[model samples]
Target: MDKKVTIYDLAKELNVSPATISRALNDHPSISLNTKKRIVSYAQRSGYRINKFAANLSKQKSNTIGVIVPKLNSYFMSSVLSGIEKVANGHNYNLIISQSLESENKEKLNTQTLYDSGVDALMVSLAFGTENYDHFALFRDQKIPLLFFDRVCHLPNCPTITIDNRKAGADATEHLIQNGCKNILHVGGHLKRNVYTDRFTGFKDALNKYGLEYKPSNFIETNLDAAKIEEIIDHLINSKEKFDGIFFANDAMAVACMQSLLKKGYRIPEDIKIIGFNNNPISEIIQPNLSTINYPGYELGVLAGQSIISHLNGNINIESAESILLKHELIARASSSSTN
Candidate 1:
């Protein structure tokens, strides 16, 4: 009575084999419906609890997927996690999620911990400070399915899921230019990450295409922290050339800077049209709705989950796996609309 109730105890009590109990519990199709119902009913009545560790040991599969993200506070990350959870749960796989808090050391530790925990597969969104990726080689060496989403890096045999950030960036910049924006300024994050770098590239390309001169002063490589909005506002206020349009790498920074610029008597659209990447919910809630690139976070997560699952089930060969690039859209709103 004191010990934990297991399938073996339930099997002996119900006069069935342990395999039948497991099959019934897992809803294996080979077991008859009536037999499954009976075994499940009796197991519930007997307080039987599945020992996943033991089952995993016998099957050589943990039936668990590990996920690592930069931070959990963003709406985009939450949506991605939700999509992944939906797909993983539908496949009867459990998730072990961890956040890196944007620290390289923390990300390394989390990766090692998840690998050591015997996860069947691993998914990651790299941290900003993660310059070294040697830590992830453990999963590659072990032949465990490894996937990257959002902020990804190239690793042999590891598939990546992400939107076309460069195109999205160009789309956002072009939208602003179409709305009559010239002398635009780009606010971005660390250029070490592809997302920010690609967006910046797209911005510059759009500027070049529009016959607008690209100047080093027109771009700001920031940390993208909302708390540092004042520094950006000061930069804008003190610039020799007044920017007619602004494009931010992410919505949070755009929204924060918009509020501050407004407080400083700058008018939206009329004074300086603004466009941001990642159509986060806050983009709509802000006073003058923000124009942004619609980065499909949920869809990216779903595809990542499906790809990993397919690889794990042997339905797809990981060695020949191709990286997935989701489409992005430019959403025009009051903040960047010429009509406003």
Candidate 2:
């Protein structure tokens, strides 16, 4: 097996002291530019790689950030991740990403692993079933910068970034009401999550503003699993009151509900109007384009990354538990057209 090249080899070949080589590699201001260039060129030619572990120990920084998400298969999540990676890479930082697969246990395990791996910072979008936040204590105890986006919780001194889910939800529901939907049903996810819970609050507020009676049967809380489409369909059909509009928490569920409604001989907008969140690609590809909120996931990710990096660089003091709300817009489409 071939031995890895080191700074010692570069120093020997360049006939310079190891201290001079180290200073040059680190770009110390005392070292002349020409000498630094020469050492860098020689190191490159010799295939010398700096030991990051030793550097991290010396500087007390790992130069790596940890990110945990619920899952990696969704288009929206992937888009956000791409934006985060772009920003992190531009700042010469490495990202260690993991998926929690919607389990709190898995999330806890991943958090511990990332901590042990010596990540300088951490970012998270909470898993579906994460109720206990004890796993994050290590990062807090060590004073590591921790940030949350999308699905977030209130943690002390940790900044969170997300759209105002309540306002967006109210806007979507109001749009349905404006389209002449008398009996609107809301299809949402677990209320334990801030996104869904706040959205539900907005849904009820809209109904109250319109002088409509808020009924318990008007809300259907699910995991937004496509496999539960049949159950949602049955629930809709079994409702005593006819549903003329639906506001889904996500585009995936909205698309699934649209398909099931069509299969049941109901025409979109003509018979029932629909709106969803996330503005996912499937929203446009469906037979009747789905009306949804443009959540700006990529922009959210970029902003989150920039905020954490700024905090890490001591450019900003993000000690308060502040929430950064991004703007959201309603995109009208065939699914919720008034003319239909």
Candidate 3:
């Protein structure tokens, strides 16, 4: 018997994308006739057989859900995923997860791959560079339930679960302001993302509410990766304003920056009060415990999973679903409060 050949083998031989091969083999109109003919000829010669189980998937409910995240290894994201997995597994549903590595093109590719895999529903946490959302139109067109969590975006009927970031940001800043910090700095990620944008907005709102002046240099936007803590340190050291306090967007960056500042002989909560978001475990482990917002990542994930599953089971209409906002609280720790 001849070995069973797959589309990957065909794509490798034809020097085309797997998507193009799949399209050509399916006689999709978008593929040029020449390309289709070439693919068909090769498939026939090599006895390539499409997986019948996958081919028949649309007719039969696969009981499978797909998820796309910016990155897979974050402490906060892992907690969210744990909640999602617990709910999904309890309901006997399977999850197909992919990471975009924070790239727009990779996110698009993952969307296509998940759609082609016949997922009944899809969940996504947007990538940093995903300005275009057209890749998700197919799911909406096919009446598939789509849900967004954490780093979410607007997608017409798709529901979203997240904290009130603007409020959370404001609270953090106001707390710092109340603690006697006059000149404060916000270390954040790209403003293109809602999480970062909302946090920045909240920070500004707090400053304005307390009659503090806002300067262009007050906000320093970076990739927010921990490895680049030196850049933050440099910005802090080289700046003319001499920031009296700092609010970091995430705990990882906040913790790393705190360590760097301590090593550089800066006093925490005295010289430069600091706080971060997400309440990562490291916040407590550090010498001066990090103050942060309890973002409820795990609860957010459980709610997101349940919401999507509810829509899938016809328990609710996704089109009418409203965005769910989880409550966030300020955790006053040694790093931020002067009293601590």
Top TM-score model:
2
Q: Candidate 2 has what TM-score?
A: 0.96
- Candidate 1 per-residue C-alpha lDDT over 1-340 given as tens digits, one digit per residue, 9 for 90 to 100: 5589988888898888988889999999999999899999987877777887898788878989999999887889998998899899999899999999989999999999998889999999999988999999999899999999989898899898899888888898899889998889999998888888989999988998999999998999999998998999888889998898999999999999999988888889789999988999899999799999999888888888998999998999879867999988888999999953
Q: In angstroms, how far off is 18's CA in candidate 1?
A: 5.2
Worst 10 residues of 2 by lDDT: 1-10
| TM-score of each predicted structure versus truth | 0.91, 0.96, 0.83
The superposed Cα distance between candidate 1 and the true structure at residue 32, in angstroms, equals 9.8
Regions of candidate 3 where Cα sits further than 4 Å from its true position = 1-58
lDDT tens digits by residue: candidate 3, 1-340: 1778888999999999988998998789999999999999999999898786875564567778899999889988888888888899988789999999999999999999999988889999999988999999999999989899988898888898999999999999999999988899999888888999999999999999999999989999999999999998998899898898899999999999999999989889788899999999999998799999999878988998899889988999767967999999999998888743
lDDT of each: 0.90, 0.91, 0.91
Return whichever of 1 and 3 wins on TM-score.
1
183-241: candidate 2 lDDT, tens digit per residue: 99999988878999988999998999999899999999999897788888888888898
Q: How well does model 2 score by local distance difference test?
A: 0.91
How does residue 60 of candidate 2 score in lDDT? 82
